[model samples]
Each structure stands twice: as C-alpha cells, then as structure tokens.
Target: MKDKINELLERVENFRPKAVAEIEDFRVRILGRKGELTALMEEFKSVAPELKREFGQKLNELKRRAQERVAALRAEAEQAAGEASSQIADMSRPGSEEELGSRHPISLVRNQIVEVFARLGYTVADGPEIEDDWHVFSALNFPPEHPARDMQDTFFIGKNPDVLLRTHTSSIQVRTMERQQPPIRVICPGRVFRNEAISYRAHCIFHQIEGLYIDEGVSFADMKQSILYFAKEIFGEETTIRMRPSYFPFTEPSAEVDVSCNLCGGKGCNVCKGTGWLEIMGCGMVDPNVLEACGIDSKRYSGFAFGMGVERIAMLKYGVRDLRLYFENDVRFLRQFESAL
Candidate 1:
C-alpha cells in the first residue's frame, strides 16, 4: 500500500493533460464518488491501531495530492483547449454583422419636401453655394445699401462687393431667371450662409428651398391657392394657414405664412408659444423690378416667388424644439426618426 501511494504521487506530479476531456476524466478517476480516494478511505479502517495514525495521514496526503494534480491538469488542459479553439475555429465563416445606416432625418425631410413639390409639376434647379452679389442680392432686387450686403451680416469674398456667400436660396431663383426666361416654374434648394451667431433658434449656415413661378399673368391669388394646397398636402388636410403682411427685398407686399400648430391643434401650446400658429415661410409676388432686372418683360410677365427655411419647415413639421439639434450628429437623437423613415 505504501509503495502504491508513492508511485501514484510520482505519476500525479508528472501528469499533464492535453485536452479538456482528459482533465474531466482525471477528475472523475480521483474525485468521483467511486474514485481511488474513496476506495483508499474505505480501507483506512482495516489498518492496525498503532499504524492507523501514519496510514490516516498518508491517506489524507494522497487525497490532497490527487486534488492538486487534478486542478493543475485542469488548468493546463483549459489553456491548451483555448489555443486549439483559436486555431481550429472556422476562419471561412462570415464575420460578425455590422449595423446598417439609414437616411438622416433632415435628409428624409428634404426629400419629402422636394417630392411633394415635384408632384405639383415643379422641377428642381440647383445653383452654386459661393455666389456673387449680383446673383444673390442685386438681381433679386436687394438694394445696394441693404444691410444684408454688409460684411457684418454677409460673408464677403476677397473684400469684393461682387462676390460673397449667398445669404438665401433665392439667389438660385435669380440665377434661374438669368438662365431661363418666362414660363419658368422651378424650385431651388441649397445651403445658404449668413453671419449670425449659432443658437438653438437660429444657425449661421442653414438650408432653404425657394420657389419661383413665372408665366404671363401670375397673381397673389394664384400664390395663395398654391400655398394653401401645399399646406394641406404637407401638414394634413386639417391644416389652415394665415398670411400676415411682411417684407422681402425681391417681393412686393410680401407675407409670412403661418400654419395652425399640429401639436396644439390650434388650442395654443408651448410649441406655438400660445399663438396656436407656427410661421412656415415667407412669400410674395415677384416685384416687377426683379423681373425687369433679370431681363424679363415685367409688364407682360408677372410672377411670384416664395422662400422658406428648410430647417424652419422641418422644425414645425416634427416639433423639433432646438435648431442646433439638426446640426449635431448625435446618433441617439437621429435614431428617433428611424420610424419616421
């Protein structure tokens, strides 16, 4: 029995498992209910009383050594299994899936707006973001001394009056006029630049879609009907618009269009500032001077022009409280519109 104990101890000290299954087998052989340790413990009672102490200690030592050997074998086997797992893993298998991206909320809204107008026979016209004063302001009937042309309000280029960042998409309207004659019906959408401090309510850089409709005899009434139809189409059929007198350089007797707040349902709310209305856009009959400046026969061909801040329209449509949020590329905020897409 003593020789058997020493031999088993030597074997345990030298034992090494190459796999997890071998370690499991070793555990069951030494530690399971019917294992070698249990068999030795059952034989402990048969030893002589005088030698019982020594034999008992030997049995305990054997058990301890067996446990240690099993633990060490398990650790080695686990490490081996890990290395083997990495080597044997199916490298040909497809990698983990990557998340897909979606259209931005602002982009989705812009497309919707353009699509709505497109359905009404409007063709899209684009122009340069960096434009000259003649195309941006002067041709659009902006006075030479207008504050918009000031360096403090406009982004001037090379200290020249003829060159500057376009302050509005209406600049595209002027460009379209110079390029196309009467019977021109088009929508201009582009980025506009202004020299204003960024804030929750306003941005120095924003987007606008200005609409121009020119023919033989366009009037304020035609403009009104068109705006109303657009309002109904965009804001739902329940929408109502109120046009308040306003002013713009290119439009005579210009008006600001306000739609009944969808959020408050015309009962007044925080979004509408208790006014039950949200200003959507500014519009007016194209001043004859503007038409004449673009070389159109002002008397024979009267037209109307309307311009709206795309951000403003998006804000009103979606109840976006902060203008800065649209510019911030926060994934969480944009993900809210996932369903909106």
Candidate 2:
C-alpha cells in the first residue's frame, strides 16, 4: 500500500493535460466520488492501528498534490486556448472599415437649397410647427372664411380653430416681419402639417422653404432674376425659367414658377410629362394688406415672397418618384445620399 501511494504521488506531480477537457477528465478519474483518491481513503480504515497515522499522512499529502496538479493543468490549458485565439487574427493587416452613416436625402437637398440661397445673402429663419391662425393665415391676408382655415384643410389643435399646425412655412415670414423692420431678407425653412391623406406624391406632413425680400423699390424683375440665378445654380447653367400668371392670397400678380425640364434638356420626357417644363414654386409681389397686418408700412416698403416644397425639390433632383420615401427611415434608401453628402 505504501509503494502504491508513492507511485500515485509521482503520477500526480508529473500530470499535465494538453486541453481543458483532459484536465477535467483527470480530476474526475482521481478526485471524484468512486475515484482513485476516494477508494484510497476507504482502504485506509482497514490499515492496522500502528500504521494508520503514517498512511493517513501520506494519503493527505497525495490528495493535496492531486488537487494542485489539476489546478495547474487547468490554468495551462486556458493559457494555450488564449494563445490559439490570438493567432487567428492578423495583427499586421489593415483593419476592416467601420460603416459610416449618412445624411437623409431630404436633409441633403434642403442643405443644398439653403447653401444656394446663402450665397445670395439670404439668411435662414425658423418658426414653430404649432402656430396661431394669425401668423399662418390671418396676417398673410387669408380671409376669415378662407377654405384653408377649415378643419378639412388645416389641422386644428384640440377644439380650437385659432390654434393649429402650420399648413405652410409662410408663417415664419409673418413672424419675421412682425419682429424685424423692412430691408428684411430671410428664407424660412421648416416642416408644415396639413390635414390631408398621404400618398406617393402628397403627404400629411412636408417641408417648405419660403423666401422673403422686403425693402424700398423691390420689384418683380428682381424676384425673377434671383429665382433664375437659383434655378441655374440648382439645375444647371443652361436652365431657363418661365412664370405663368397665378394667384395666392398673400401675393398680388402672383405666378407659378417653372423650370425647363432638366431630364431632357427642355426637349421632352416622361418625368416632365412631355411638356418640356416642370413647375417648381410660387412667387409674387407681397400684398399690401399682408404687409400692413404685420406692422410693416405698406406705403413705405415693398417685397416679394417665393416658396417651394423641399421634398418636391429633393424628388426632382434625385429622381425619387415617391414622396413617402423621404419620411420612411429605410437605411437602404437613405444610403443613396451618402455620396451626395
């Protein structure tokens, strides 16, 4: 029995496992219930009384050595695993590119439009999405019974007709006039809400950029030239513009502004519906009544205001057929504008 104990001690001291699984197997074979160490402990009870002390001491030392060997083998196996994992990676090679996010299509076009106007000395302006009727309609020469004031066209807050979501960014122009004196040149850009059904071309919510230039001796010609410069900058150098007489509550001698079709060099295309033209915005001289309502002296000052839908501009520029794409947060659709940024 003493010789068997000495042999087992030598085995424990030399024990080494190449892997974590072998280390666990070694532990179960020697130290587990019904294992070698447990069997040896049982055998000690049959030893003679005089020999018990010496055998007991040997058994305790063997058990201690077996436990220490198992622990060392486990640590070595873990270290080997870590080294193997580290070798799987190429430390000297270039790293994989981290994916970069991009600006939304609407934002890209909006920024481009703002940049074009910024070059012309027009400062950007903003206003609240929720507004009172006066800033949106009343102060803009909208009559009390105007159809736009109705709940069917405008989104009223709660039961109050006077407070509602702005149907257009023209509200910001009114706010600007109310606070600033003439010689005011500002471009209002923001989101507007309407009580309308959503569709590929139309939505309940949209963006608009409205420009206002008020000062002594401002004229329709100045507005036309300014718009022409903007059209050429946005579309191309050869682009041309033609205004058709139209009507708006806030602009006298109003006209809808259209640019020659860029898709077909103004010849014809399905995008322009074969008309060789595409309407872009609305513009005209500011109505005296509108100017007077906002505390601007109509007799002393005159101005022109023009407004265009930002989503519409984005669609024209990017050839996007669906207005809904701008509002949907689809990463695949938005990623198309990464290069545009």
Candidate 3:
C-alpha cells in the first residue's frame, strides 16, 4: 500500500498536460469516484491496525500533492495557450475589410435636393412634425370645410383635433412666413403624415420638400425659370418643364409642374403613361389671404411656393416604382445605393 501511494505521488508530480482536456482526464483518474485514489482508500480499511496510521498519513499526503500538481499544470497550460493566441493576433498586420455603412436613399435624395436649392440661394427651414391647426390649416388658407381638415385625411393626436401630424411640409412654410417677412427664400424638407393606404405610388407617411420665395414682385415667370433651371440640373441639361393650370388653398394661381421625360427624351414612355411629360411638383403665386394671415402685407409682398415629395423625386431619379422600398430597410434594396454616395 505504501509502494502504491509512492507510485501515485510520483505520477501526479511528473505528469505534464499539454491541454485543458488532458488536465481534466488526469484529475478524474486520480481524484474522481471509482478512481485509483478511491480504490486505495478502500484498501486502507482492511490494513492491520498498527500500520493504519503510517498508511493513512502517506495516502493523505499523496492526495494533497496530486490536487496541487493538477492546479499548477492547469495554470501553466492556460498561460501557454494565452501566449500562443496573443502571438497569432499580430497587431502590426492590417485589419480585415469592414462592411461600410451608407446613407439611406431617402437621406441621399433629400440632401441632393437641399443642395440644389442651396445653390439657388435658398436656405433650409424646419418646423415641428406635430403642429397646431392654425399653423397647418388656418395660416395656410385651408378652409374649415376642406377634406384635409377631416380625421379621415389627417392624423389628429389624442382626443384633441387641433393637434395633429402635419399633412405637408407646407406648414413649415406657413410657420416661416409668420416669423420672417418678405425676401424670405427658404426650403422646408421633412416628413409629413396622412391617413391613406400604402401603395407603390403613394404612402401614408412620406417626405415633402416645399420651397417658398417671397419678395416684392416675385412673378410666376420667376417661378418658371427657377423650376426650369432646377429640372435641368436634377434631371439633365436637356430637360424641359411645362405647367398645367391647377388649384390649391394657399396659392392664388396654382399649376402642376411637369418635366419632359428624360427616360424617353420626350418621345414618350410607359413611365410617362404614353405622355412626354411627368408631373414632378405643384407651384403657384402665394395667396393674398395666406400672406395676410401670416402678418405679411398682401399688397406689398408677393411670392411663389412649390412642394414636391422627396420620395417621388428619388423614384424618378432611380427608376424605382415601388414606394414601399424606401421604408422597408431591406439590405438587398439598400446595398444598391451604397455606391450612390
């Protein structure tokens, strides 16, 4: 029994494990239930009484040395593994190529549109998405009976009908007019909400960029030239614009602005519905009532306001038919525009 205890002590002290698994196996062989150490303990029970103390002391020493040896081997193995891993990391080497993020298509288009207007001497303006009825409807000259004022057409907040999500960025223009006087050349770019079904061509939540230019004798012709210049710059140098008579609450003489189809070069295409022109925006001379409502002298200050959906402009530029793609955040859809910036 003393010879067996001496053999185990020698084995435990000399064993050098190359891995953590080896250490676990060694521990199980020495200290686990039904192991060599357990067998030795059982054998000790049958020993003569006089020899018991000597054998028992040797067995306890053997167990203690085995446990300490295992702990030391484990520590050494872990340290060696950590050193090898640190060597492999190689901080001097260049890092792997990272997947770079990109600007959203909506943000890209909005930035482009804003930059175009910025070149035309128009500064950006902002207002709250949630607004009062006076700034959204009354200040904009929308009549009390207008369909837009109804709950079906607009998103009213809580139980109060007056507080609602703006139906258009035109509210920003109205707010701008109330604060700033004539010679106010600014563009409003922001999200607007409506209560409508989602479709390829339209959305309940969309972005609008509305421009307002108010100064003495700001003519419809001035609006025409500026829009023509913008159409050429954004669509192409060869692009042309035409206006059809239209109506709006805030504008006295409203017209729908259309640009010649750059896709078909005015020869006509399916995108234009067999017509050479594609509607892009609405523009008109600001109404006298609207001017007066905003504290601007109606007779002295005249202006033109134009509003277009940013998504609509992006659709035309990118040949994207589905409006839902803009909001979906699908990687397949977004990856295409990574190089656009």
Candidate that would win on TM-score = 2
Error of 1 at 208 (Å): 0.3
Q: What is the TM-score ranking, best to worst?
A: 2, 3, 1
Q: Write down the lDDT that model 3 would get.
A: 0.93
State the lDDT of candidate 1 residue by residue for 174-269, as single tens digits: 888888888999998889999999998889999898899999978899999888988888899999999999999899989999999988899999
The CA lDDT of each predicted structure is 0.85, 0.92, 0.93
In order of appearance, the predictions have TM-scores of 0.71, 0.74, 0.73
- Better model by TM-score: candidate 1 vs candidate 3: 3
Worst 10 residues of 3 by lDDT: 11-20
Put down candidate 2 lDDT per residue, 112-136, tens digits, no spaces: 9899999989999999999998999
Stretches > 4 Å off in candidate 1? 1-98
RMSD of each: 10.5, 7.3, 8.3
The alpha-carbon lDDT assigned to residue 27 of candidate 3 equals 92
Superposition error at 290 for model 2 (Å): 0.7
Best by lDDT: 3
lDDT of candidate 3 over 216-290, digit per residue (tens): 989999999999988988899999999999999999899999999989999999999889999999999999999
Off by over 4 Å in 3: 1-95
